[model samples]
Target: MSDIIRRDPRAEWIARNRLHPLHAAMQPAQHSWMGPNGVIRKNVHGVGFIGPNGIKRIDRSGAQQGGATKRTAAVEVQLPLHQVPSPAFYINVVPDMVGGRLSSHDRDLLGLARQLAGSDGAVLAVVFGEHKESAFATAGVDRLLVLEGHEFDGYSPEQRVQGLRAVDQQFNPRHWLLPDSRSGGGELGRRFAASLKERPATRVWQIKGEECIGRAGAGQQDLARPLPRLILAAAECADPISDTRHEVLPVALSTALARSLPRIEDLGAVAVDPAAIPMAEAEFIFSGGNGVKDWALFHQTAAALGATEGASRVAVDDGFMARDRQVGASGTWVTARVYVAVGISGAIQHLQGIGACDKVVAINLDPGCDMIKRADLSVIGESAAILQALIDAVQTYRSGAKRDAA
Candidate 1:
């Protein structure tokens, strides 16, 4: 029945088994290439997405600018992760104000996820919040696990850590990804790395290898494990220029430094407060800037306000105000309900620190500056005159209230 003619015994055997004559003479292919169990194998891995802010639709086009605060996350299929034949991916769902809405930062993260997903595993999502009509109904996830609780509301660093640790324990993922934000992402990333004794690169925009080594021997790199996790914290703003010869070079340097060290430690818990950011619990905020003119004006303004007066670094250099209360990137990060910026040009470096406030009032002679643009209210005048008037007004208001109560 078979198209074969028997000659010598070995020749007949080779002919019957469909083996090439030269290969048979040398060695058998199955014994050399096949596994002991006659099967080829590869390890499976998982990637996790920890979204604290969550996804929301922010309309930055300036046309009726508004967006709903909701949390939505998505995963994409692509390179190494997806291509690995049996990999898994998960999304850590924290309360996201911006749901499903892709900001420039979100798109960058998503792009990386998709590029790395190549057929290795299925991407899954774990959402935390009340179930909605269409919460985890995205295309990427193979299955969605919805966790419900009030702890998901707002940004709780401790709660997030617990949730992520739980996910990692259950899923056993090789990589854990975090989106960089002002709130608490960086601190969490560093803490996780330090706690696990694992090497984590934050603000990572791309990944090169997802290979596994097996087991680390002395300096031989950790193998036996799947692969190194890539954590990306894409910057919402563009990178600062690294030029020192220009006029704005100092500001550029300051911006670069801020980017390099964005994480602010919990100064209270730490024994030594190196950053020297003023405590937010100050009753009186005596702030100074270019407007104070000189050191005498600084004291005069502080006395007039009956508050702690401070100055900008420029003021400090010009011998106008003290080193403390200099609120900017290099200076302290203040959170006073009432913040006054006198005689100061609102540089981007300065604004980043104070922008998160209840209300901000600007007092500047040059009304066209950026400070005026970002302030809640702008008073166009000299700092000395305004300070006197404000002091009088505050005193009168307090006296009137006391009298009325009597």
Candidate 2:
């Protein structure tokens, strides 16, 4: 063999495509690099290679490299902590806390509150019952008040409003902010405003100096009004706080809250067929594509998972699915919490449609497909096999639960 250097285009392409299985092996070794100060910095984790003596050896000259080397530690970036020792006033925020965590809407509401709070005022987050969220500080909350009790759990908007009223009495916040979403925030905000006799700016999307802008009358016209004491903000109202962290200091109401008689009874969620739900409003979607050879298995899996069915343009055009079941930029723009794409090659239009989805799980035989590149999790296999595995796992889990109940 000649001792000449050569470049392999295949290796270069694999290195660039992160979704390729061989991408990791194609990465160049980064043991040392010139620092910003012009000094050579050595990666401690990438120090030495295993020598012939079956021991680790170090060669600063770069000959004895790549042996017994461990992966470099990922650097954790910490934002600056923002503290308010004493606040002149408060900007209280009531978040939906969907699924016991702060959703994107909640973060947007908190961001709006942060802007309203400014320097002298504190951003106070008022949460109902218990929550699993742990990023209140980073979400721009200067103070947190949790109203914990069974009364605040489930569908208890009346109790939630009472708690908010209690917060109003104690804090007398400069402004109150809530997400005007279908997930309870809109109703709760309206009720709270009615209770306080405050005319709130509803569906507000933007807030300038002294005026607020919102959608009104079937969302066909924009309504501008003077910034009010209460606001029901729409989604994407303002960017979420990312630059700085807040104190998240714990606060409490001065007096015990007065409980209001419940007008609504708490009933657990009712199971409904995913087919009846609209694609745009569906929280979980299982979409199929041309690669899906077994349509029956695809439908079975969707039904078992209680997920709304969607299809790529190819599937819809081929008459495997209805036109309304299509999902993409050309079809319905879905903002599902979890979108499962089976055998879909992920056309640009399809990817664009699910842009706002929180998570995308792709099952495809081709690991290098665009769907795999965009997926948060990817399973490289026949879709039928993967669907069967998922169904079996779910059945096993349910059987165990039934046995435990007995």
The candidate that achieves the highest TM-score relative to the unseen native structure = 2
lDDT of 1 at 202: 48
| Candidate number achieving the greatest lDDT relative to the actual structure | 2
Clashes of each: 29, 2
After TM-score superposition, what is the CA distance of residue 355 in candidate 1 from its true location, in Å? 11
Worst ten in a row by lDDT for model 2: 49-58
Q: What are the runs in model 2 whose C-alpha is more than 4 Å off?
A: 1-73
User: What is the TM-score (0 to 1) of candidate 2?
Assistant: 0.80
The digit string of per-residue lDDT tens for model 2 on 1-406 reads 9999999999899997867787866777767654322235344334363321133434444345646654344645456678899999999999998878888778878878888888788999999988999989888899999999999988998898889998999889999999998989999999999999999999998899899999888877889999999999987777577667788999998999887689899888898989999999998999999999999999999988989999999999999999999998899988788899999998878987887677899999988887897899999998889999999998999999999999
lDDT per residue for candidate 1 within 75-156, as digits (tens), equals 3322211122345554332222233332233333433443444344433344445444241222233344454455654454
* Alpha-carbon RMSD of each model: 25.8, 10.7
Q: If scored against the real structure, what TM-score would every candidate get?
A: 0.36, 0.80
What's model 1's lDDT at 297? Answer: 55
